[model samples]
Target: MTMSKTRSEGSLPVVSLPLPVDVTAPAVARQAVRATLGGLGLDGPEVDDVLLATSELVTNAFEHGEKPDRLEVEYSDGRLTLRVFDSGTSRPKLKEPSPMAARSRGLQLVHALSDDWGHELCSGGKYVWAVFSLARADASA
Candidate 1:
């Protein structure tokens, strides 16, 4: 796997990687996000939330979406954005799984953890993105 970083004057750094479309995708994504967030000097519950959400996104792509392409993690202005790209036509939905259900709560967890989340259709497929506020004060309130 190859990782790239981009930064400009007054712009925050972005770390992106092309993910493998298999069981290892989630683990790979979590590792990348953990290192990236740590390097940015961020920790605490907010960072944990980001890591969990990144895993869910990557897992969804590997299971439901087609040709999971890339994962991007970006931190800017006290906010963190995680996006997963896939060459799939169907979009992710937030569903309320039954309490006894064995699965299908990934998006639900994402919605609860993230300040805002959505998906957008791109040229070949779509990308689902989740945004989190890294400010501890905001999270408490």
Candidate 2:
């Protein structure tokens, strides 16, 4: 698989989920992200990276955003976007990776894996999103 640099321009491709606020809901977020990327035709290590990043960001939302059931995803044009919306007003941020700490790696991981990610304010709260490039789907001979 090839990892290319992101161009300046892009479009939105997201799957928004309004889930009940649960605590550290990684499994559900994993399923949602996997399904979204699966539908978008991505596979292999890229798929795993996308899923891992999604899980981390979703966990951060629950831990910091304090909103669980508001997770959502958007996939389009070779991009699988993961968004976790919460009632909290705080925005998501990436901190320097610390090797001595036992935790505090969610945003670090998300920043490492995704091509680009950010947060946006919604009507009721805020949404944190991570977007990864879709791997080229192999065609049947």
**What local lDDT does model 2 show for residue 116?**
88
TM-score, every prediction: 0.90, 0.78
Q: Could you tell me the lDDT of residue 114 within candidate 1?
A: 97
lDDT of 1: 0.87
lDDT score for residue 111 of model 1:
97
Off by over 4 Å in 2: 1-14, 136-141
User: Model 1 clash pairs?
Assistant: none
lDDT (10s digit) by residue, model 2, range 90-123: 8777787677989998888888898988998888
lDDT of 1 by residue, 1-114 (tens): 677985532465788899987899999999999888877777887888899999999999988998899998887778888999999989788888999999899999899999
RMSD, each candidate, Å?
A: 3.3, 7.1
State how far residue 77 of model 1 sits from its true place (Å): 0.5
